[model samples]
Target: MERLFGRAWLVLGHESQVLAPGDFLTTRMGREPVIVVRHVDGSIQVLVNRCAHRGSRVCEGPRGHARQLVCPYHGWTYATDGTLCALPLAEGYDRSPIGVEELGLRRVPRVETYRGFIFASLAPDGPSLLEFLGPLRASFDDLVERAPAGEVEVAGGVFKHAYRGNWKLVLENHNDGVHPAFVHASSIWAARNGAPWDVWEKTGLWVARYGHSWMGDYHDDTRLVAALDHPVFREYRAALERRLGPERTARVLGELRWNSLVYPSCSFMSQFRQLRIIHPIAVDRTVVHAYSFRLKGAPQQMFRDTIAFANVVNGTASPVLTDDLEVYERVQDALTASRNEWVELGRGHGGDVPDRDGTLRGRTGTSEIHIRNQLAAWLEYLDMGGPEGRADAPAMAPQSAQRSEAPRQSRNAPRPA
Candidate 1:
């Protein structure tokens, strides 16, 4: 894998993470360490956390409010905008070119906000946030608007997990609705007491354009739909109706069950009200952050149900996800061996019918079409000159994996539309 910024989506943090002035957050995209801060003037900024004086990290904590990014080594202070606003000594050297302006922290090439979510791009060129989001914008709007209060906040903290496999596997898993019936057969069966879950039969699986796709929509399936029709969903719909009116409530809630993948590295399973982050630490080892979201103005039980679902399905302790983790780990270990250069993606080969917007649909949930969609985005990033290219035109490429093996490509790889 290559680290090309243009070919892939690199910026990952959202604006809501830093709400108050002086609020700061530390995170990494691809390989760059980022510092997101709400400056004194109440504006948000993203800059490289490395200090100009010496190549040392400026921010030490995950998140906090700070007076300034004080480099503890020499007490060098920088403003939230990455400007070198203060110095400890007046005259350390007679003739120094280290002017405050020259020594300001290096800011990322691009930064922007959508709704309240903040994002930064280390690369200078590619799709703007709106262009990049594509169909995802509507899904995100629904995620926030469906709430009675029309706002969402991070809650229940974040759960960090690791898998000994490529981060792409997680993306493939997220857009893969078919796997639940088989990969999660144990849990699904147990949930249904050995009876075949009807939702499994009539799953409303969809693979949308631009690498966005979803699984797990059987809300109308008489048997499996019963699960969501319970008091929790009913109350949620009622509250939403009061806030947005009957039409809007029906539009958001009764529309669909969307467990979606945001191209490159984000997952929002709307039903669960959980958002997961996939941070590629290394080719083989990836970090997963599962954050719970509270629907603003929704009932306490609604929020509690969101948390419970996170714990029951997406949490590290989840019976369903534990098996997934194990499978991912196993896949990583096995791919290291020498047998073939390509992994199997022929599950629904030649059968994917093109959707209205050029997205390909699979015959069933287990089809590898979702993985194919993700790899299309991955390859596009690689083709764009990836992270190693010049500053003017960034390219997208996969960050290299630790072990050496020819990067696999599918035999029936669809021509990306």
Candidate 2:
């Protein structure tokens, strides 16, 4: 876990989260607490959340705007840039050799941003942010390009859901096309008022270069939404095309799908009209943050429509998510008692082909390629330290659950060119 944290770029917060100086938000990089702050100069900084003095955490609330951070335990204070500003009693340390430089909040080694998404890496020498993102870069482009200026901000607040299951379960479920029909049947039934499943035969799964994947329909199915009385999707597509041009618009809204899992940290799903961040609290527990936003040049009604859909499908206590949580917990529980070593990744597993662009395309809607991709990515990250260290141990298995399974698929998820 430590090696994984050290080796990978971790998303701390969006640039919009800290628009003003002294603006800061607290989050975790692996298990360590981290703070993302905007300095007085408008530059962003990410620092380890702990106070250098006595190792107590400096930032307390989830987010705040303060001239300086003051540790509650003692009077130690630091500037927004994390420079040690003051210690309540200077005489206590007069004879000692300790200096202000060493006491400043520790900065995360490698911090970088793409569009407005800020990410940090604890290890200094690994891949740059762009290098790490690889083919998954297009998804980020697709996201921010939805706005007129080709940018986006974190808006509409965060929708957080907590569940008792291994974080891997959520990863597996993100692009698991098969489970949606079965797991979300009641929710879909209610949404469509008990109509039979609208599973589209035209749908497919995509696996991108770095394990980013999703399952979505080939195009908007007007019949699926006709009963909902929401005819806005057509006009929305028209609006996007008019504003972004046919090619750019196609890149942004043309695909018309959901669950673009951006590797280990985030998933952007337009089907629910939100970007989700998956935070692993422990092996057996996870928290999901769902942020819904509006496009800058788009109509106000568009934002409202998106949020309305999100409220129905991904909102807290959502029928769809509620069902998903129940099943995740059930799986976790069953795994605790099962004698089986490897769970199945066999459902519609092998009908994948590679595209000319090097993406893996799964022929079946219910293919397990996405789960298989994520599991492999997870293991590859865990093996960063090589065979001599923690990699040799079966730490990927949660103490409360049984062993996990991962396989390989060569095709990749597509991002707009």
Candidate 3:
């Protein structure tokens, strides 16, 4: 945790969660509780939630508006910016060398936002958030641009669930295009009468630096957001065209990307306007918070579609998600009992080609290249002797050039039957 999450930028929440001064949301940055609050100065502050007087966490609720943070233990109070403001029995510390000014809740070393998504880092120095995001910034652009008013905000509350599995499993599963056919077979069989699937054929996989990856649109307009001819969709498109013009609107709507991973933290679907943040509690336990976004100027039906998709895919009662949760737990159990240290991820190995944008494109969407890319990043961040260890080191090199070295087992292994 210290090496991977402590040193890396992790998404906290969206800027919309704390729009006004004193608006605040409590979340975890890899198990450490923290508060993302808007200050009186009109700036966002990421403060450690632990009270200064003692170690008790200050914020218990998920989110709210607060003029100041008061510790429940001893009534020690702090301002929205994390300044230590008041505390009980102040005269007791009169003779102490340390003053109350030195006891403010520790602020996260760095905080940044890109396109209303907030991120904070515990490390004092490293690559800026922009450099860490690399080309994945375009994924956020794709999301916000779909908003007719050129902005998006969190809506419809959150869908939260806990699974008895490692957090990495879900992150890996999201971009593993091969799993939905089998993992979601029950749901598919009930919905589609067991039709043969060919989602990967239309999808493209792209991997970027710093472990970021995303899948191109697998579902066409007809399946993705109702038919392009649907009246609500037509209205949504008209609204976008007014702001972005007809040509730009056509280009935006034409782009079809699905799940995108921002590495070590969050995965989101621009098509459905859903964002899921992963929180690791222990090696065998994980929690996820799923949120839906509303396009600023889009029709109400559009947001309704977002909610319906969330219920079907991300909600706790979702058969699709429950299927995945069961599989994740089973995999975790198997992994705990297995003797082998290595799990193969060789699908489409050595077949990824470089794209014009400096990213690697998988030969097929079914490739496990996304998982491999994530593991490579995991190794990089965990390596105390690697670039992440040094304060001045540059970000990891693009994984495209590293694909030449295939795993030894993959070279000699027989193709799967």
Which candidate number has the best TM-score?
3
Per-residue lDDT of 73-140 in model 1, one digit per residue for the tens? 88778888999877677477575524556688888778887756677767677567776676567667
Tell me the spans in candidate 1 whose CA falls farther than 4 Å from its real position.
1-7, 94-99, 193-201, 208-210, 219-235, 356-358, 386-417
Q: Estimated TM-score per prediction?
A: 0.85, 0.85, 0.91
lDDT of 2 at 158: 77
How many residue pairs clash in all the candidates, one count each? Answer: 21, 8, 0
lDDT of each: 0.69, 0.71, 0.83
- The best-first sequence of candidates by lDDT reads 3, 2, 1
